[model samples]
Target: MSTGRLIAAYIFGSVGRGQADALSDLDILAVVENNLGKVAELDVIKLVPLQFASLKPSISWYGAARVAEMFQNGELFAWHLSRETVSLFDPNKFLQTLGTPAPYKECLADVRSFRAILSGIPPQVQQSAVNAAYEAGLVYVCLRNIAMAASWELCEAPDFSRYSVFNLSGLRKCPISVEEFDAAMHCRMASQRGLQPPHTATVSYILGIYSRLDPWLDELEELLLRKENGRQYAQNAV
Candidate 1:
């Protein structure tokens, strides 16, 4: 794909927000002027410098029109773009014109996304250290999303750090010890960095934490569902 077709590009997530740690990966969003269809033809690796290749880029592609629509609809992507992203390339300044989305809408979207992930989790993760670590990280992300949504609803800035989510005041107290959560976060960080796989102890600790957290996850889901239903009812009554 020609670079001329690119409308804008941004770095988001931890790195963009200046909260990245040693293990953070790069998240890049490329908005193209034309609808390139479902299959992305652009090779991101070819665009970055050779030295930065080791930092494994997680690239997301979208059409310019789709991004504009997302901004108009107050969608999660638009929220991130407006509030959390650092624009790297934008000759036309396309992203500068967009406004930050409503925090409540973003919170609801986070709840919905978390619920979808929770619904898809397998009853038993495969018996491999890597698999176990990956599953544990997935659960951690789901819990973090719940905490983030709650924080946003309260008009507080949502922090994506593991420490913030694990210590969220309104969240049910984590049954795992602080050491255990630390181990899980380390395991996740290592996995993301493509380092050595998690050890058996790390895997067991994370799984145990997940097992204990199941009920809390259920409660969180129920609360979100009730809030959504209430919103619908209020809309209808109006």
Candidate 2:
């Protein structure tokens, strides 16, 4: 099996199909037998969970076998093991191969910056856009840190539906449009076997605090994307 496909099978086999979320990253660890000289072929595949028809999965392969070798030796593992990973699947053997831990000061800074942003928004605006997404980000970061401390291979995405188990499901459902709401509710009922009114007002109360106390949330999103992409670019440069 191809490297990427092999990893997907493991994720689906271990975590069950359809468990990954839109924001989840796929962390694949492949071992090449006998230090194969100048090996070339490697692949990765990602699929959006639902309703992301036009988005294509991001794929990357190292042109240099040296890069692949270093990666397998854990040179690039720290980035994945950072405070951003919410692991979906990581094998036992691979877990034993963990490299040295990276200091998460940078990660903590980003998290603190995001929380700081939450404090600068207006009260009314906080009641809407700012609250829900900010709280989601906080939930995501906390989960990411927890996953890292556990030594699991961290995929940089959180499974929101999985995240729902933390009482954030209702919070995730808060941002839906009428159509989105109906669909999400349908899925919720199908999965849970009953209709339950979302904790809209409750989520709002928590998110409201985050929103009003923060800066515009969009700025934080852009900052995180830039930082994450920058980290990937740095890793690729290694």
Candidate 3:
């Protein structure tokens, strides 16, 4: 629990207080009374980006009892309960008390839904939108996809807008190749009309990575759509 407190105390915005529904950046505190009449405090901190869509960070804080109160009183606790890839401090017993594991299949379903939304983005927008618009949207959409995947797998979610992960060296291991991402960036940049392709060779290198990453998602996509079609077919059969 002290690790949770330390995370809440030291990590700028990880612990979110006040909002029953925790947003991107939050500091949360948990306080309980011991048999000895001493108060034990647990803090959980999380860093979430500002925009519901954007990948920017913000700060917030709260105590554990308050978080429990909110969960009892509000719908937002559902979000907290749903998160699987959280960086827990003093995770030992408190997490186990939170109860049975959530079905990861549900989280994967959410990821597949998010991917569908992304796939719906018009190719025309990809071809013509200004660089900033594309980058902004890309940061949101791509990171959400990545986050949902990590959440489903109960793995750490990378902060892609952060240079440490989104940069050339980092994305080499990502599902989307650095080359395709760069090409996408280039195409968006060149959509402005006067610029020449600055990094053609790198784009090909990236595309090669995309070739590897893209197919792996096929099963996820199929699982998602099959479920959807089944639901619809069942409705019609009814």
Candidate 4:
């Protein structure tokens, strides 16, 4: 139960990237030694110093050996930890020892993860405008990740800013406005805070955003397809 047992900890996601806003949560990963069973019993809030109480941390616990295995296997989650983390505690430099992740492979994994999330959305959840708006916001975030991956393949830096994908010249060909997209994102945050916008307005905004994103999704799928084909070809030739 002692915090002293933790070998390493890291802050990641928006906080690690220095992009936190009022609604952002602190995403934390803690590595421990020989206490995997005790993880569930630990009080995470108590482990966090009182100074960070306002940050609303979401914590995940992992054993040191498991983390090392994940890094060696090129798991996307481990890759993210290696690439986008600010070490809170690293007496052993465990995070530093992880090899650099393959960006293309990470991007493809993210695309698949996002697609799974979208596909898992129940039909009933979309019945409410607020719910639809929230779902649309998730979709927009996923699209941004897809755009970043695609951009990386083209030798461009990955842009993680919200809705940055819509600003791409290629995506500008699709019919969507900044205002409409913004509303969907706004509606999502507001809904979480228990403030719902008009149902009709929310639904309209979400529909518009989705319609515009459709073709872009198609393009992303094609990009992944090409990457997979090339990877298979290379493996076959070898």
Candidate 5:
């Protein structure tokens, strides 16, 4: 069972949240005494049962101390674990003892990082047939992560839902329509499932989605700035 070196193990993400479908891949974490941070797949893939190998569970390996540090720092990864992890193996209840993570404080920084990635992708890169689906996937991930981080910055509990983008405070000001965002989401999921239609206009559709991301990011940035300023104002007044 490899329990000698393994300290904690759990499933997280969609499956942890009970939002997964038949097509969803498992997100697993294995905390080992030997590895302190990220470990290679081969280091832990064999620990998974052969029956579940076909599902291709995405596994992560970390050292116990590293997990403690992440929890102490209140990173987004910490919040995710605190909010949505179901224990598969926890003889010592290590994760349970870690308790709630510190408040996430890098919301704006993360949003800006996501913005940089989108900008760096260049229009030509996004338009390429080879990168169209990949670009859409990146956008989907960025929007979801932005929403989660922004929620913490807004003094709200983090929103980790698949559709978290639509749930942000200033989401009404977001330029992207629900339908357009959803189209990209479907494309991302389809790509993950290796589904390519005989005839598809993925390039054109992803470009259209790209057009709206700029204004959407602008809206999020403005909202986050306002919140930060409001906090500063209250602090200065006191």
Candidate 6:
């Protein structure tokens, strides 16, 4: 009840879409007056464990002023929360006071940035399966955002789903397979929730699949970046 420095919090992602399963973890954006240095977060979460056990929440922190800044900057994540979020805690209506965010306009650039991060995965996975969970987690997040950003850029319905990369289609078939996608997703969730890492067999499987991951990043990159019939990419759709 006495949540110090916490301004507001909201639920988003799968739970936001009304499409969560036992496997899905709750995603929370906790808008705080300021970030509690990392060590204090462990102490604060000890405040409410049982209540959040079933949902297995993953909380991302943002300073209240930072949230306002993100809105002003027209960040995709700001728009994402605006569209698909359910307020969990807000005594002062901090988010409501912020009002609508500026339009999202930098999807292609974001996609390119995430793709660059993914480019390192193949070499890392090739070196050792010990980091398979980390490598798979990278692929999962990077590819998911790449798809989401591309959707926003193309004037398509934005999908913030874990499987959005696979969900996106029409221009080219998804390079990620269902099984591969699921494996990577589990790795990410496990890392996010500090749960047990993936099984040895899963690590091996992910490693095998990753050797091919880089080759297709180039493929999907082109598809996402292509201009359709000389049309300009969408801007300010939100």
Would you estimate the TM-scores of all the predictions?
0.72, 0.29, 0.36, 0.70, 0.82, 0.77
lDDT of 2 by residue, 7-83 (tens): 21122211233455543334333333333322223322233233433333332322334333444554323344322
* Candidate 3 positional error at 9, Å: 6.2
User: How does model 4 fare in lDDT?
Assistant: 0.63
Model 6 lDDT tens row, 1-238 = 3344777778788887887888877777877776552224544344333645587767788888788998899888888888898777778988778788887777768877997887787677778777788778778888788888877754466778766766666455565588777777788878877887667324566556655656665666676557432345353332
lDDT by residue for model 3 (1-238), tens: 2323331222222222222222233333333322222223311213232332242332234455544454444322333443422333443454334454333334445555655655444443445443334443343445345443433333343222222224222123346545455555554445444455444423234334444545545644554456557866999999
The candidate maximizing TM-score is: 5
Candidate 3 total steric clashes:
27
RMSD of each: 4.4, 13.4, 12.7, 4.3, 3.7, 4.6
Better of 1 and 3 by lDDT: 1
Where does candidate 6 have its weakest 10-residue lDDT segment? Answer: 229-238
- Over all chains combined, what TM-score does candidate 5 have? 0.82
**Which segments of model 5 are wrong by more than 4 Å?**
1-4, 36-55, 126-129, 177-179, 190-193, 197-201
Q: Which segments of candidate 2 are over 4 A away from where they belong?
A: 1-43, 46-102, 120-203, 206-238
Separate clash counts for every candidate: 0, 10, 27, 0, 0, 0
- Name the Cα RMSD for model 3: 12.7
Candidate with top lDDT is 5
TM-score of 6: 0.77
Error of 3 at 77 (Å): 10
Q: List the residue pairs that clash in candidate 4.
A: none
TM-score of 4: 0.70
Q: CA lDDT, every prediction? A: 0.65, 0.35, 0.40, 0.63, 0.74, 0.72
TM-score of 1: 0.72
- Least accurate stretch of 10 residues (summed lDDT) in model 2? 5-14
**Which residue ranges in model 6 land beyond 4 Å of their true spot?**
1-4, 34-53, 192-216, 228-238
Clashes of 2: 10
